[model samples]
Target: MLNEEKILAILRLQKCKAVGDILAKKLIVHVGDVVQIFREKTSHLSKINGIGKHVLKHLFTKENITLAQQELRYIQDNAISYSYFLEDKYPQNLQHCVDSPILLFEDGAIDFSNKKIISIVGTRNMSSYGRDFCTKLITDLAPHNPIIVSGFAYGVDICAHKVAVQNNLQTIAVLAHGFEQIYPKVHKKYMQQVNENGGFLTEFWHNEMPLRENFLKRNRIVAGISNATIIIESAEKGGSLVTADIANSYDKDVFAVPGRTTDLYSKGCNNLIKNNSAFLLNSAKEIVNMLNWDLKATPKIIQKQLFLDLNENEQKIHDFLHDKGKQILDVISLECNIPMYKLASILLQMELKGVSKPLPGKMFELI
Candidate 1:
């Protein structure tokens, strides 16, 4: 659970008209703490490279603060669960996305413990061929035990999710709106089942509507949270193509199932492969090979790195890892008294600096 003050600070940033996730992260990193961003003087904050008059005018405004307080109260009273982008609990793969939401509201039990997560998305208007192929792809991949991710919409998104549930695989639904309501209305029937199997995730606040723009924004979460994104079937234009493009931009693997030259739904995917944007997927075996699911999972070992300087947070983490040989993320955050969110970023930076090694399942140690 996120603490009240920190949650409120983050909420305030969210409400700030001029501030978005990327800029909010800049403010927090510059201020050293989320709570401190509000306490900071306007003069000092103005000096940050991205900080400007419009941002200063909107940030900490009375309206924004009041709105943030109201949302904070809602989270507390409802016992809402969420993930801070900087925190260990946030999807590990998504932490690398610069524009990822700073906070996400979560529902039910979504587990990232099984890191084999793949997103399958495509046309809402599905053909029998697409449905059959999607069902088989998921059923075949079930043994590898990947968590399926999708929009929880009609056709392919719903198909991937239902098949995953049938296979008893954990699945995640990235929502375009808040928890208060479900989009397309019909999928509401599957909510309890999804929550039982995995759960739903959204960056939207309570009661926010599913606007057209929201779905486009929601595509990023679906794209970023997964190890790879697969397009089941698509026409010349669609949202799934946008998701595939986003995945490619992140340098993550993207797979497109091929179809006949004359097939209407295959155009977008064929173009993706033809343009070298995605790999031409032949079978589930290829997916398993590409992601190395067939390989055994183990921690990476490296010799102790020497002669590196660390910032205050990095030093604290280094000291903890130096004493504890191979510690999981949660233990280090507690031992170092650093928030899991901030600790995650610091650990990644340390890894890049060659001062630490990261293991599967959020474990870390000195190199």
Candidate 2:
């Protein structure tokens, strides 16, 4: 816990209309302390980059302060737990995201020390194929003990959570609304099990509703808090795709299970795989191999296939990396004469074939 004054100040900053997470962070840093931001002169705060009069107008309002005080009271009374973005206890992966929430309200037994975190997201209209894949994926990955993160909504999200709980893995549900109520009403039954297993996380205040925009905004947390995001199933357009895009933006691995072309719900995932926005996911082994997860038990000794069939572009990129060692994505794109957009998908295909591995700083090397 944070002290009362500091918590109130953080809440006030969150309530400020003009100040988003990124701008709020800048304000806090400029003022040096959360509490001091409230005390600093509006004129002085205006000098900071991105902090204009509009932001100050909302920042110093009496209404926001009152709201903050009420929220602070609710927090104190309910014993609500939270994590500040700057704190060590905050989700490590999410901290790297520039637009991540400045504060996260949490409930239940959430522990991020176990770094094997992966987000599973997909369409609300999950099919039997999607459900089977989600269950089997978690069951297979149980030995590795990865934390399963999802939106905790209907379909794939809830299925992932239930499977994680069944397999005795911690599962975190990133909520769009506040703690006062559960969205979809039907999911309330699983709340106790989730709390006992992993718990719910949200950035919304207690009284906030599960509005359309909140779910979209909440996708960032679902995307950024994990090392990779998996889309079990999706249509041509859905929030899971949005989460995948955000994960890619953060340079995290994204996976999508392939399906028949005629399947309605598989379009988004197929498009993602086809465009190279996500690696084609066949099994949990692919995720383990890509993420380099180490199992406690002796690993299975499956023989590596003698040769991987690579397309012309993949072969070119592969040979380039094979000769020059690890190279940045841009250099590879330029040297191979492939446009960056097309090259990203090609590289992802190469990775899925187990012929290449992505490194930090957008570097790639033949595996």
Candidate 3:
């Protein structure tokens, strides 16, 4: 009963998720009329006023009818979440986007409740300063546990993600294609780590290619998802500026980390700042402090309080290890739900106190 013709007809619509769904629902509503028309009861529905030839042509076609059923089955089985404009879970701020995706495939725990989210974007081909700044910035802001968002591109995006992973924060990559394939296959290992530690999200459906247009289109989602956007380092041209502009259009804050004015990589950021289009951010702490993110956690268990009492930020850290036992840094971040940098420092203090043990692969256990 799958309508292969209908499927092909729908596909011909091109990027028609929302549109096709609407049209399909309409067809269902007129099923009686459609059956009659197909059975020759109405002598060619095209003759009926308001029944356009195009719609009638497709509607009566046996191929389209079969394809329609197939598409319906595919949609139902995939369990894909469509974030239509009317959906309750759809982000309110992103509803007005011109290039907004009609559907999104989400994986992992996504919390839009976080009031403070800043996009850490930069050039794919980054320099030493960009790398060092990103690491230090993310580490410093680990306490606030800002949800890190970025394109899972080469260089800066992955660097930021690596730091975020190391710090134990939730990071989401907005892919240029569907979730079926990952761009820059080299990051497959890192992406797996992201899924376990954070998650990867996308607007394109499964099997979509990482086309150039998709990347440009996906940048808007990156800007839309966050409250602010930051550019670390970019040449005078590249996709980073595109994200910054989208952020501005969305009325979201745009910030740029200043680099040496003379540096080639700094040109895009410098121009953004010079144009007064973006705030000049020197460090992650500034972004954290500016956003007023609530990162400090209140330990509820008696053991946590007792452990805190036993040591200052340092000794109390040992209590986590001694009591909870050894865990990989990533595992601890997830289980403890704490940022990686803070977890590491807390763990380091325990190690120095001789109350904790360090294992291979950056794991720690109680001594």
Candidate 4:
């Protein structure tokens, strides 16, 4: 646990306009401690990478310190809980992301001991197909006792949370705003149930509003906190796709449920699958299989291939990936001497043939 001074210092840094999570971390590492950052001379601090006069101008402002003090009082009075990025209790998966928040506010009984967390996200204007798929997917995965995470907005987010609650599975609502107010107010009704099931998490302060950018910022947490992200449904463009892209960036597996060619919502999922950004999800089994989740009582399904065939390029890529483990597309191309444009199609073919799987961060590994 952080002491009062350190916590206050963190709050102050968080309030600084020039500092983001990445820069904050750099500052802390450079200064040797959170408190030292505030105590250190501006001249010495500026010497560190990414720290400059512009950032220091806002960093030591009286206004930021005053605001931090006020927020600290509120946290103390209300017993608001938080986790610092350096703490052991911080989300493990999120810790891997370069831009994850330096601090997180949380409520209820959120636990990450299970390790089987999966985020399900999609359009706020959730279609019936999306709803049905979200419900069934959680229900089927319930036996494995995975935590379901979503944005807690309407449509797919709330639906996933509700279904997870019904299935007695832990569900996390990663909020875009502060705990002081809930967006869409209608979701307030389900707050208690969600708390009982899992909990709410946010990086925003107590009074922060649910601004448009916060939702986009919150997507990284939803994507990073999970082992894999499932896009139940999406439009031609949506926040869920953003989450999928972020998850891909984090090297996490992404799954997209397919819909008809003409369906507006399925277009996003179809595009993700077609471009090999996401695996074509048919059922819970695909997730279970890809993530290598073990069932408590079910017999394991195994498909043995007696003969595996690969052409010259596929064989070279496969051999390289198999020997070296996960490799990004560019590195693979360089090592295999394949042109990038043509390599993409080769990798997609490999993915379809069950020879390899695409990971976030443009990486591939043999399956």
Candidate 5:
């Protein structure tokens, strides 16, 4: 639980009209603390990059302070649970997102300790085939016990939630509106089950209605909270595609279930696969393999290599892989401070030298 003062400051910054999540984060980083952002002088704050006249003007407005205080009271009176972005309770995957909400309000018993989170989304008018694929996909993934994250909308999102519940897996519903109300109204029936199983997460304030833009804003949360996003079905223009695009932008894995070319709902998914925006999803196994979910069950013990001819960067990578065992290619690049383009060639050179080998799913290990 966040201290009341900290949550109040976050709320104040969040309610600032001109400051978005990115700008809010910038301010926090420059100010060194959320509470200090309010205490700092306007002229001093103006010196920070991205803090413009508009931001300075609305940042500490009395109205926003009043609103934050009211919302803080609402949170206290309602006993609502929330996570600050800087806190451990915030989902780790989401914490890495640059634009993730600074203050996320959560309801229900949500456990993000299990990091294997998958997001499933699609059109509201899901076909029978889409329904079947959605059901079977979550069912097969039950053994993996990944948290199922989805929009709490009609069709694919609801199906994913219900199927996850049936399989005894935790399911999270990212709501576009506040907890005061549920969109589509019909989903209210499933709230208790979802609450008991997983929970609903949102950044909206209490009493906020489900507006069109809110759903678009909510998509980022859905895409950000999971390791991968799977599209069960979608039309040419749909929110599911938007979510997939967001996930891709985040450099997260995206999967699209293919259907007949003529199928209207599959067009968006087909285009995604064709354009290489997403991988061709056949079953849960592809997700499990691509994400290396099953590899965690058995740890690989890599032997430290003896003296070998290697460059400084190559040796750094080799020592890293040797210490960590099998690691994803992106992780290697990040940990070793090598760019992806350079890392690929270096790994290939290492492969030729017989110092390392490539594994399934872009993974590398010391040979």
Candidate 6:
């Protein structure tokens, strides 16, 4: 059974936006005694080093307690499960975050601990090129079977999720709002599809809206969950840059596909490349080489045989990956002339067959 009191404790702590580890340390006198503070409402919190009467008042106030209970019950009733920061099932990658969410709600069957993960983020008012790049990039990376992570907003975010699901790749959308309701009603179909394909994740409980600030708060998860972030397109100022900045802060690699100099959408990306904030990538092959990964030589295998198992579109990917050696998703899509949406599924089958591998920097390598 879930620890109800502990759950309430987490909800209480989340109100302050304090780091989970910091809160945990300050709430308990010692490591062994940590669970006690969460298990019961006691004066122990008041005795903890940094905690004050003011903080405690907010935590134990009648209104706050009522709200916490309501949120917890909604989660429990919906069968939405969450793992506390120290719980075994919590995302290990996010565990190191200074402001890591104390409790994360998940609604999907996919495991976050799966092999490789990458996040793709960009502006909401994306250009045609941005949309195209998102499709193709994910398609090429899909074969490596990395879990795709994003914020699930409009533009590149929704595009990423669509491609990921089409490729049969597991995708996780970390939302800023509570799980009680999805923010954009337009994404209802996509959200339902993702539940069966990957899952929806959030730190909020129920009935939360996607407020402007909430989206910003959610950027941490997008950066924290993935090994790297691929910025397909952005403007001078937008949410895409926010994710990129967060990714850099987390010490994760950021890659951008350069666009025309005059294109406003490309300005942010080109600036990133110019300022050395990101690597200028044109192919997954370059990304693979940067990561220094080489699939060890094996018996000469029949390439056409692998192609035979794939659909016409999938076959194109097999040929493309084989010819390109290893490349970024954007370049491959251009070279092969494949649509991003159609390419995702092809990559999925290849990943399952060990024909390709997704790398840390949003690149894929052919086996």
Which is the leading candidate under lDDT? 2
lDDT of each: 0.87, 0.89, 0.68, 0.88, 0.89, 0.73
State candidate 6's TM-score.
0.74
**Residue-level error in angstroms, candidate 4, position 218:** 0.5
Q: Pick the winner on TM-score between candidates 3 and 6.
A: 6
Query: By TM-score, who's the top model here?
Result: 1
Candidate that beats the other on lDDT, 2 or 3, i.e. the better one: 2
Where does candidate 4 have its weakest 10-residue lDDT segment? 295-304
What would the TM-scores of all predictions be? 0.85, 0.81, 0.63, 0.81, 0.82, 0.74
Model 5 lDDT at residue 77: 95
lDDT, candidate 4, equals 0.88
The candidate with the higher TM-score, 3 or 5, is 5
Q: Over the full model, what C-alpha lDDT does candidate 2 score relative to the true structure?
A: 0.89
Candidate scoring better on lDDT of 3 and 4: 4
Summarize candidate 2's per-residue lDDT along 245-321 as a digit string, tens digits: 99998889999999999999999999999999999999999999999896455876645556779889988887787
Decoy 2 TM-score against native: 0.81
lDDT of 4 by residue, 224-287 (tens): 9999999988888989999999999888999999999999889999999999999999889889
Q: What is the Cα-based TM-score of model 1?
A: 0.85
Q: Which stretches of candidate 5 lie over 4 Å from their true place?
A: 296-367
Candidate 1 or 6, higher lDDT?
1
3 against 5, candidate with superior lDDT: 5
